[model samples]
Target: MTVTRDSITDFVRTLEDDISRVAICGTSYSDIGGVARVIEQQAIELRNGGYDIDIFTLEGTRKPPEDVSLHALGHFETSPYKEVDKLLTLASPSALNFVRSANRFDLIITHRFPFSTLGHMAKVIHNVPYVYWSHPSGSSDELFEGLAHAWARVQHHLETQNYAVRKADYLCAVSEESGEYIEAKTGREAVVVPNTITESRFGDVADEKKINEQFGLTPHDTIVLHVGRISPRKNIHRLIEAFQAATEGEAECKLLLVGEESMPEYSDRVRELADDDVVLTGFVDDKTLAGIYNRSNVYATCSLSEGWGLPLSEASYFDLEIVAFESIPAVNSLDGAYPVVNEDYDEFREKLCEKVNRD
Candidate 1:
């Protein structure tokens, strides 16, 4: 079935009559990245529409909104070996048992791997239908470079991710590129439901004074902002280098990097490259994030790839000048954003300088 943006809400509404109880499954509910935000938004919207929404996770940190139920399966371990933890979660007998004993769900919507495996289990054991929401495939060659047991991780990702896609009763992707990737890899059609931004969430006026005070910024500072996880795939090191070159000798200009660090080692390297002029504000609340966006002069990213680049859409809502690389799938989808050649640091720097100095 073809699900256009106009029909997305209608399609979901149709499900409400038959599917009264819905379960959203993911690894976590924290505001660590875009996936968490997407799950939150989905839960809120479904709950508001009178659907009985329940969120299942391996670990539950952040609280769900009012009237939304949260269930933590307690299968995740706090281990230094992230890959091992993921493997355990995927093969967790406890999680499978939880699904077997828990109240039957009318439908399950899964976000990503390991948890998507649970949705598959529900379908097999309880005859429940599941929808897999495909995000960007994290199998980029750049992501595996210089990593230990890279081949093993890559193989595991391919096997599990492909299994989820193939087993899902329905598939939906965050962007057109994501949908195409799904078809290319698993020969499955995915409905394109692009991530959205609620303009009303952001204030009409930016709390410049609050942002300036929080980040030690002056009114004269020309801020270049990047909001997302600080990970190797994001290419934050390259962004910092380009920002430095772009704003060299401009004392009042600053670069603000937001969001939590997903990869500690890569984040540490990025921190090493950042001088005093660069501020890394890790994991802010929504209100502070809104203030940060509203007060910023430009929104910039050097991300090698993205499923949808939710931050870019949010930045557009704030009317900030966007600077990104043309090679990014999300950048190509956006209008009026400046895109430099992929990995061309000199061109990226030049473009950043042009946009930063424009205002």
Candidate 2:
């Protein structure tokens, strides 16, 4: 269905203290990456605004706020058929219970794929309306790049997500690129609600010197940072290769890879391609990460795809020089981000070198 500005405004108005509950469901609820962070923050804001919330999700390392109801279903372990696993999880005993009791909530909001299918099920079974919230209208190889089973897996996701999009009452796109894709693919209008950074959390004090000391760096050291899960689609190996070429004649350019390893083998490959100048801080706290962003000369990513590049947004907020592929919408939206054509590795390297060596 077409989602207009008035409809969105009406929806917000309906989210008053009088509403009993709102269900926010997603594929995962961990600090694992962007989707989790966005859902967590949305839930927090909704609850704070006097709306009661229930969080339904697949198993994840992080848990929701205690005040809200949490219905975590499914396994924590990775599987070869993730799309099939999601379908099974949604059909699980706990999920069936949710289906039966879904009327308790005023609205169901779904994040990412597959879970949107679950929310669609709620719409079909309980006559509830579900809001589809995610990007990349259909799965593309961009997400599963470097993985052996990428072709088949992405095809499965594409089919499932297409169905989810069709069933959703309304769509919420996190960026203009995604909104356009949704409109073109599904022939449905989507409300664009961009991802945001909490200024209070990201803006306070940061000790650049202390951060550099912690990383064993010096005044001459130029840090190029990439903050995201160590995944195949991130094309981090390309970033590593570019960093090498960019700093070949530099004084001392360092590349810091932060965030958890989503794929161990991929992470290992990144490490194997690295030298002394590459540092991997698996994952750090918010304060530490903010400090590192402050200390870094440039924030870079060679990701093949993104719904919305939250790391790039955060980097832009931190006032770091941004460098990323033009295909990434969030980076392109920023004021000073240096965006190069997606597949132009040579130009990417040159831009990185210029930003790093800039006074």
| lDDT of each residue in 65-114, candidate 2, tens digit only | 65887777764235664544554565567777877888888788888655
* Clashing residue pairs, backbone N/CA/C < 3 A, model 2: none
**Cα error of candidate 2 at position 93, Å:** 1.2
In order, candidate lDDTs are 0.78, 0.76
lDDT of 2 at 258: 91
> What TM-score fits each model?
0.90, 0.88
Q: Model 2 — which ten-residue stretch has the worst lDDT?
A: 1-10
lDDT of 1 by residue, 231-316 (tens): 77788888999999999888999999998887778888988999999999999877899999889989999986777788898888
User: Which regions in candidate 1 have their CA more than 4 angstroms from the true location?
Assistant: 1-3, 6-8, 14-17, 91-94, 101-103, 144-161, 198-206, 333-336
The C-alpha stretches of model 2 lying farther than 4 A from their native spots are 1-11, 14-20, 63-66, 76-84, 137-161, 203-206
